[model samples]
Target: MADASLFEVDTDELRRVGNTMVGIGDDVAEVARTAPMDGRGEWGHQGLAGAGDRFGARYRYLIEQLAEDVDRGGVSLRGSANAYEEMDAINAASIAGLGMDW
Candidate 1:
């Protein structure tokens, strides 16, 4: 089997990536909320205008969903990093209680 020791967690990188994800999500949400839907009025035909409105509404909905998903992922990533740190601390305390030294 490959050495498990080769696997390592880069908590700082995880946090940075999480922050970036959150920022991107916020930006996307802002754009989705502010984007003009009035362009549908410019369509020449009534059918085209209605289709455009439907498409625009669906696009906004999808964007909102994406923003929510990304925000949740960012929170999970950051929380995972913190959990890792807490686990390490508990492990250290256990080792000390057992009179072990690293």
Candidate 2:
């Protein structure tokens, strides 16, 4: 798609993505809040930490999307696409502090 921004055809798709991300984030947070805690439960923080990890992942996706839209002055189409995946891989690598951290 020559001259296509990541959002050139349908900006609404991005909004849908964003809304989905927010909804998931909210769900995660709510679960963390309401879930029962163990005695002396520093482990309860794992749920909240997992939620933050999810939000960070969603934010990373948004950033990768914006990068695709940027074009970077004639980068190859495949290169542009690959960049986003690589960004995701890097983000996934850095995720931490989630119980088993899975």
Candidate 3:
């Protein structure tokens, strides 16, 4: 296996991926909110319209859930990038201290 120390986090790439996810989530949310649905009417059309309403509601719910999940994933990725940087700094400080004979 390769040495773990050689592993490096590309924070700029991570941030770009995260931003992309966020944009996708936003687009999904917007589409879900704005998409047109069938209208209600008398006779058989009413039943079909009712069914369509139910299906549309479920669809919107699912889309919103996916959007939320994707947005959270993006936020988590960005947070991880920041955490890795902080850990790297701590490691460097610790290594520097070890070299000090005091």
Candidate 4:
């Protein structure tokens, strides 16, 4: 048995969660890309035009940043999963070379 104090990992779960995060990021990015940036004529008040533009720009920046952050998180998760799996394989190989039977 592994040491109780050591951390355990489920690589498949990590990959699954990573995929979900990537999909969510893609969805968020699509919305951010498609959303209208200019609300100049949409609002009845002329004073709202400037505010709308400013808000739109800020919203776009925030949404895009969120998408990028989420995407990077997913990538990081996948990388960790891959690293764990690779390490497991290497360990297995080393054990086999030692002719140790469990």
TM-score of each: 0.83, 0.29, 0.82, 0.78
Model 1 spans > 4 angstroms off: 1-7
**Candidate 3 positional error at 41, Å:** 3.9
Can you write out model 4's per-residue Cα lDDT over 3-72, one digit (the tens) per residue? 2112367877888899999999999998788656555778788778877878878888899999999999
Give the winner by TM-score: 1 or 4.
Answer: 1
Task: Give the per-residue Cα lDDT of candidate 4 at 101.
Answer: 40
Q: Rank the candidates by lDDT, best first.
A: 4, 1, 3, 2
Model 1, poorest ten-residue lDDT window? Answer: 1-10
**Preferred candidate (lDDT higher): 2 or 3:** 3
Model 1, 1-102: lDDT tens digits are 011112257777778889999998898898789655677777789998988788788989999999999998998888877877666667668877999852
lDDT of 2 by residue, 59-101 (tens): 6666555544443322433344456545544544565434334
* Per-residue C-alpha lDDT of model 3 across residues 1-102, encoded as one tens digit per residue: 011222377776778888888888898888779645745444267678788778888988999999999999888887877777677667767777899421
TM-score of 1: 0.83
Clashing pairs in 3: none
Model 1, CA-based lDDT: 0.77
Query: Cα deviation of 82 in candidate 4 (Å)?
Result: 0.7
Q: Which ten residues in a row have the lowest lDDT in candidate 4?
A: 1-10
Better of 3 and 4 by lDDT: 4
Which RMSD values do the candidates have, in order? 4.4, 20.9, 4.4, 3.9
